[model samples]
Target: MRTVADALHDRHRDQLKRSQLQAHPLLTGCAPWVIRRVAAVADEVLFPPGELLAEQGRTPGWFLLIRSGVAEVARNGALLGVVGAGDHYGEVPLLGRGAHPATVRAITPVHAWVIGAQRFVPLVDDVRPIRETLAASLAAQPALVAAARAELASRIQSMRREGSNTWPGIRPPRRRRSVRVLHVLAAIAMFVAVAVGAAAMYHPPYAVIRPGPVVDVANDIEISGAAVHPIHGRYLLVMVHTERPTLLSFATAAILGHHRPVEHVTALGGQPDVERQLHGQFTKSQQDAALAAAAALGIRPSASGALPFTVRFRDRDVVGPSGGLVYALAIEDMLSGADHAHGRTVAATGAIDPAGDVIPVGFVDDKAIAAQRAGAQVLVSPTSEVYLAADSGVRVVGASSLREALDRLAASN
Candidate 1:
């Protein structure tokens, strides 16, 4: 048998060969020897939906190249853009020795290839075409390029307008002699100024802005009816019967705040006793324990005369917990009179801390898919957990706090 060190070297060599095949165009054209050299220092990554790929403003340890699936890019709750298959992202900071400009989230389950900076930087020095292509691509993107051009034009115009030079061939019209004419002119100028100001305030270009608090109201209520359990089954199917649909509504709303919204709750019929199943079968003791746990969680038989209700707050039309922050914030904002649901379906997922920070929860990908199915358009998510919001084709925003999510909804409305 080969020695342990020899086996490790063989495994590493195989990994390097794989990396060489996935390298970008410039690197792709390199000789086999060079490719092998680069691959020796590369790493591979696989991220499921809702996994964080990278954070904003942090120096990246690896140069990331997406091999498959989509990733969302955002900064301060505003979506920057999407990075899809075969794309190279997260290189800006690495190349410039600057802070990361945005956070990268996996929008779909992803497979990526990574090269450490120490090895990648030296390769870039020899690959001039790669550097040129990257620079050109960055400069050509419409959003960034257009903004830069507009700013440049505005500055030039300002310099001209503010310059002291007089027109070479034209003179100002002599002052009007009539007071009525002067009054009319002054009124016209004032009207024009007001119009300009209003336009500027109301029609600001649609640049991404930081999100605000989210608030949603109980729009309607529905009851979750009864469920039957088989006497011999391993798990007990217990229906969560509630008099106030708002309680379930709030839970659903909170779910929507962080993830995309589902068109409707899957109507799973009843809650399954997962713990009992793990024990192989439900005994008398297991049933009692399950009941006790449910009771502690406030799930019990409804009292007489308790009306069944279902309240639809807003639907993100996607499934997942990525929008939890937005949903919770929407509820709070509505309660505080700071916002109203303008009839747009909102969806999100995440767990809300008492202090209003959205904590990462589970099932982000499924939650986004469910929310999309429900027709939710605006998705709010915690900044830390948005990678789970991938590939459902819904627009997603990231919020650092509950307040930020509410503000995003309020402003959008």
Candidate 2:
């Protein structure tokens, strides 16, 4: 018995929910489509004063985004803080916590838009910006973070206390009577341990790519047998950390959502000897960079082989040709005696050929995160990979060749 007025009213309510989601401060960086998806799953709820919105030591069921009123966040009677409109909580549970770290109680009549864990956890696992925003929010609250850590210890102590007094009136069983039970329990424990060990050792089909350390090229590079010129700013070489995911790690990533996983074949390019292949590419890239630098500077290579100058990078476990563009820029900058970077921090990633053409590299988004973390102001990437880092919160410059990269850096303020 639904009327047209009821249908119109429902539609209006739905649109209002979407609008509220769009205006959320923490979700401002998220894509429109992601917000739409979240809005579709969100439900409006009201909590009375002194009501527990989320209880400590209980499994999380919903993620709340407050629209009005206020709530108190606490851990075992210790108040963490008060959150009102535009503030959020209930994320610690989504991050693989078996229980809620803190209790959220309504300080006043609370109104919020809530998404159940079934919907919210997947959204966080799929969307990178949402995860980053939530992580930053949690990090900004030091007291809440400490309470979360203490929650684990509190649970352990409570568990011990409960178990310790459970058999107060019962006498201990005789050793002879308990021998068979003990042996069976021991066998079961051994079997479980072996199974867990085997699962941890087994490799999954996916490999994870994560951001690695960013090295400032100006300070880390050594130039021997050449006139090294001083520069005013730093050039950074960004790297990625790769891991072959085991069952446990793969499952953890699937549940928690901070790491990205790709097919193993795609990651290593079906190479049998990944280390040697990457190392060879690294060596060739250095040579090509030096040659390109010399050619750009109008210097002919020595009769021996290449230029008389040698460029050596600090010893690092990272092996890849993606640093070629940065190396060439650093060498060219030093040899040309021009301050290309001026007074800004520049980070770059791309493979380079002897002719100074910049080749596209993989994982530029991850590299961009590393650059931002290292305080880089500008990131230079191949034209094809520039869009990958567009949302990485850093100024990205796309270049097709070495000359273009140099020109952009020199022109940028």
Candidate 3:
């Protein structure tokens, strides 16, 4: 009853499915029945060269398994690295509530298999080999991998107790500890500090500077350009320019890896509405409100007579009221002779608190793209934002505080 063209299509689809089953490392150990189930749920996609496979920071619908050619991974516009045949991408967001870490672009004519999450979950559940392989793959990732290992371990333990000896030579369970007794004892000694001799290397605490006499001269300067250069100097200073107090403080604190004094100034306004519109896909009034809030901060009229500080501008309007902490820090680093003068631009994002703790910001991919456009070589971000940097192929150092950022910069230089 099938026409010739229809028959050919079915044959091609079957061939592709067979290739997928044979090539995937995880599928290798799957039973024949499980493989057939996965094949039925999988779809094949062909893309022209230069096509966008996926966008950064967005949820993906499929777990892409590359079959041929190559894909370039990027965050914003910065290149993260390349993925080739037999490699899998998009597993990060597929497993979590967070957005996709990077964008994938086709570097050549390509073919790939797309498996929906709903279907993939069942396949993983039906096959132990798939679960084990995925866990092992994610094991190197501290956040996700640790959880995966723990879950896998628990599952294995439960199976052992049930007398399902699927995995042979497994060790018996160890004796349990007294949870209640340990909790009480640990709480009593929580504040005790024992003095050990100074370590061979000790990182200094991060200090945030306010509008003191030394920094007042550099507060309103405009940055002509910014780029992350190679580590030719012994120290580096990263600056963020935005009107969001929360973002500025958080960015500075996160990058510096310790609490530091932040100088506050009303410099420029940001495109909060545009950002919200782009990120949340909001309606007109909501977008307008965000824009209005961003527009509240007016731009400085001229760069003339402004301090010689490197000014960071969020939304390019120069009217935001924040980013002073980052700008001040960069200027301080430059003035303090910490190096980075030879065209190295370091990029980062965070909201600055009044107390100077750097908070996390959104659209990390866009910020990374902006940094790359400005010719940055090294980018530092909060530990939470490292995934964006990794997917974009940017060399990123993760810091929890200003001091930690400085220490990383020093070490790299």
Candidate 4:
């Protein structure tokens, strides 16, 4: 019933598919037409000698069908087998997301056809006869058969529970990638959430200096059991915010002029201990400030026998000894009612000893910049290294002790 040319054309198609599919054991039961279709869509490629065709343990994106020359296959760095013309390589990634068993390299100049994995799956799916034949082969293994049966029952039960008797459209390459896209997306989202949470809650390794509340130190101190006079200028507090500094964060803070190294903080063992040390330093500052204020106001602390008062910081953020000079000044104002500031805005940063000597602190430039922006008339520091603000508008004054600071404040007013 067929012409000679028609018969010959059919015979050639059948022979080509048979030869191609039979070349690999994996495609043994596959219908000839499936192989024919695969060959139709493949791209031809040529590789020079000594070229690597593919690597082991990598997710394969394509299947290579060699047409000429030779290729060497190796597994785990050991020589495995050689593939020549008519040989096909790659299956692990095509079947499911598994590492390829071997790396394939060109032993000689080679010609091959490459089929992408996405295009290959549908070819396999269309061949119902081969799929069933392969499924039967799998069923011959008791363990695989049992697992398949159990899974099937479980899926059916689930569908019934959901009020559906039919299975939904399931995407295939039932040998699809081992890792699902949804799982990857969820992991990425969780990682991002955790990073944000850590940034919000974890203390940073770097410190920041900025203007803080100019509270009444008198509220925390008294002289001769009597409330001290209110200081006209609010005593400035240089508040510090610690950042989780890495090389990147450190660089950013440095460029912004506010980063202090963790070396000094960790010198006390750890951050908790460092925090405790700062609190102790601040406490000492309060005492020293009270005594200095009493001396300046001509109010003797010895007369007020154990003159002690509590200093309550409205902001729980006070972290270092840099606020000593300002604290003492506030105490002095409240104790003597000297009106030293004369209503002018003032700010200062320095460490202090019991003798009321102001010591140099870190991040002076940052504090100066902040004070200048706040329209401060006088920005005081312990040393002569002055940090001019953006507009260079704030005046930088040096103070060696509480007496010096008070003197400077009064003179400025």
The digit string of per-residue lDDT tens for model 1 on 313-341 reads 23322222233343344333333344334
| RMSD of each predicted structure | 21.8, 21.2, 22.7, 31.8
Q: Backbone clash tally for model 1?
A: 74
lDDT of 3 at 225: 37
Best by lDDT: 2
Query: What global local distance difference test value does model 1 have?
Result: 0.49
Higher-TM-score candidate among 3 and 4? 4
Candidate 3 lDDT at 297 equals 23
Q: What is the C-alpha lDDT of each candidate?
A: 0.49, 0.77, 0.49, 0.60
lDDT of 2 at 49: 46
Off by over 4 Å in 1: 1-16, 19-26, 127-129, 135-413
Alpha carbon lDDT at 17, candidate 2:
71
Ten contiguous residues with the weakest lDDT in model 3: 209-218
What's the ranking of the predictions by lDDT, best on top?
2, 4, 1, 3
Off by over 4 Å in 2: 1-206, 263-272, 302-304
lDDT of 2: 0.77
Residue range with the least summed lDDT across 10 consecutive positions in model 1: 233-242
CA error at residue 338 for candidate 3, angstroms? 67
